[model samples]
Target: AWCCGAGGGVKSAFPDLALWTAGQRVDEALSTGATVLSSACPFCKRNLSDGAGNRNVRVTDIVELVAQAMSGRRMGLT
Candidate 1:
């Protein structure tokens, strides 16, 4: 699970703060090598998705992902 960063307006008010926070979260997630990074909020989704960079990780809303997963339609599956 990714921590909340944009709650304090870190991404919009301070980019470096946002990058640092997102990078830290991404590193933690990457350490697990999880294919999907799920979150509840839209800002967290944006931050995590952007922080994922070139990795195979994909960010998504938990509910949306769950619906897709239940339907057997994975998000970002092309």
Candidate 2:
């Protein structure tokens, strides 16, 4: 799972800059040939997914993905 963008302070006040940062991350993810991108932080998830290319990559929370993989569910994990 990619940390996606710069995280924390970088994504708070400067969203456009954060998107650019996430774009760089997307390039790295594409190089890895990974379809799903997982992040622990909710803000990171939203920022990265929003900045990511259209349907080029799927973004999800790490806990949620694990639950899905295990055929289980997560509560209050958004």
Q: Report RMSD (Å) for each prediction in the order shown.
A: 2.1, 5.0
User: What's the distance in Å from true for residue 72, model 2?
Assistant: 8.3
**Cα deviation of 65, candidate 1, in Å:** 1.2
Q: How does residue 41 of candidate 1 score in lDDT?
A: 87
Candidate 2 per-residue lDDT over residues 12-50, each given as its tens digit: 778778888888787788788867778888887888787
Local lDDT at 73 for model 2: 54
The global C-alpha lDDT for each of the candidates, from Candidate 1 onward, is 0.78, 0.76
TM-score of each: 0.80, 0.75
Per-residue CA lDDT of candidate 1, range 1-78, in tens?
A: 446466677888987777678768877877886678789889998887777788777778989888998999857734
Model 1 residue runs over 4 Å out of place are: 1-4, 74-78
TM-score, cand. 1: 0.80
